[model samples]
Target: MKILHRTEIEKILSSLDPIPKIEEGFVQYSKGLATVPPVGELLMEKGEVHIKYGCIRADEYYVVKVASGFYQNDALGLPSSNGLMLLFSQQTGQLACALLDEGFLTDIRTAIAGAIAAKHLAPANITAIGIVGTGIQARLQALYLKKVTTCRQLIVWGRSAEKTGDYQQDMQREGFEVSIADSIDELAQSANFIVTTTPSTTPLINVSQVRQGTHITAVGSDTPEKQELASDILARANLVVADSISQCQQRGEIYQALKAGSIQGEKVVELGNVIAAGQGRADEQQITIADLTGVAVQDIKIAEAVYLASEKK
Candidate 1:
């Protein structure tokens, strides 16, 4: 099997628009259009806790994603998140290839979810951007934001400024007008499009701080018990969209909102319905939210993109 490195995958990504498009396609895939079967994930709490999972499509393609616990970095001096994508030839049942290093493929897919949120929810003339959390996920989301929107002014708020100055410097190097905010509430008030990428259990942005017409993309809440936004902020949304209602119902920020009696399931809109039915927020005046919890379908779609991208390289 051919192995793809991190730089190789990134170079392939540079020549493709699949990152954002795959998110859109995943919206379609989740809506009962594409034939993505269930992906199995198993969480094992041992020496290094992790979730190992794989997907199947009979004789087509199957991929597996393994996400280790956040503390894995402490032992290895590497980023906590890392995985391999194994691709097999469905027709011949041959092991076609393997992206044996870096979980960067998933990073691109997840970041594109934020990009899609901005494309669908943010105004055409998005002026400013605000981000909570300064992790790798936050950086990737900001990179994709620069790709998808025209937002010039950027603000960031992290749990500790001292720990994440590297994040600020990285943004500045990219030519983004970046600043570090003193508080989460400040970020909500200043930017028209806000992305929450923190792995926080508590709310960062307050409802009162958010201005009307703001578009918020809440990531990092992939599993139950990992919430990032306050329930009241959800209640303030004029339009709320999710990657999957079922996925969000079990985990993600929206699930926390539901537990708090802040929003009903009926108030939520899946991005698939928004894409297929062509009915979502319009104009620049509506307050919109896109809650991304990350899904297997997204993994499958990006894996497909990686396979197609590998065909050329």
Candidate 2:
């Protein structure tokens, strides 16, 4: 079996557009064409590890991914995210390739998925983009968002002034006009398109802070304890979309909202259904939210794409 590192994987990915593949994966998953078991998680004192694996029906291979996040890694001058994916042949159960991406694929697939969410659910005319958190995902979300929205103006907020300033500089280098928001409310008031990427246990964006015609993609809340948006925000939204309905029923912002009795279970629709029906933002004034807990199909599609791309190279 071939073993590829992050450098090789990066080169392979440069030639591929993951948005469409990820979008298709979502559609297949929502249609019940994929089998993704419940996520396996381990909580640590300062970090968490997630084991996600699955395959699309009739696909050539299945994937098993193990990724972790240690928030304090930055202090040690190390990346917070790390992991790899193992791809195996479906028919023979033999190993095909090992992608030692060091969690780069996971990050890229996630960012692309955010772009997909924005493409389908966000308002056609975006005023400004608001980003929460100053981590790798925050930067990548803005980078991938350029695929769907023409708006290059970003308002960012984070807990660390130093890190937030660093984010501003980094994004500015990427051809985006970046601004540092003094508060979440400030970020909310300025940007119509918002993506939350922080792993906060408490809600950051409240219902009153959100304006009409706003589209919020909550990406940080994948576990049961992590939350970014207030439960009232989901309740107030005109349209709420989830990457996986069953996954959302257990975790993410949707789960919190449901548990709080703020929103009904039936009100939440799958992102794949929205994409398939070509139904999104009814009007410019409607409030929309897409809760992404991440999915195994994403890993399957991305790993397959990377492996195939490497073969061609």
Worst 10 residues of 1 by lDDT: 46-55
Per-model lDDT: 0.75, 0.94
Candidate 2 collision pairs: none
Task: Write candidate 2's Cα lDDT for 168-200 as tens digits.
Answer: 999999999999999999999999999999889
Q: What is the lDDT of residue 232 in candidate 1?
A: 87
Best by the lDDT measure: 2
* Model 1 CA deviation exceeding 4 Å by range: 35-41, 44-60, 90-93
Full-model lDDT, candidate 2? 0.94
**If scored against the real structure, what TM-score would every candidate get?**
0.90, 0.97
lDDT of 1 by residue, 15-132 (tens): 8887555656655555565554333455655323333333434326655566545555667776776777776665665776777556787788889878877777886666678888
- Summing lDDT over every window of 10 consecutive residues in candidate 2, give the lowest-scoring window: 304-313
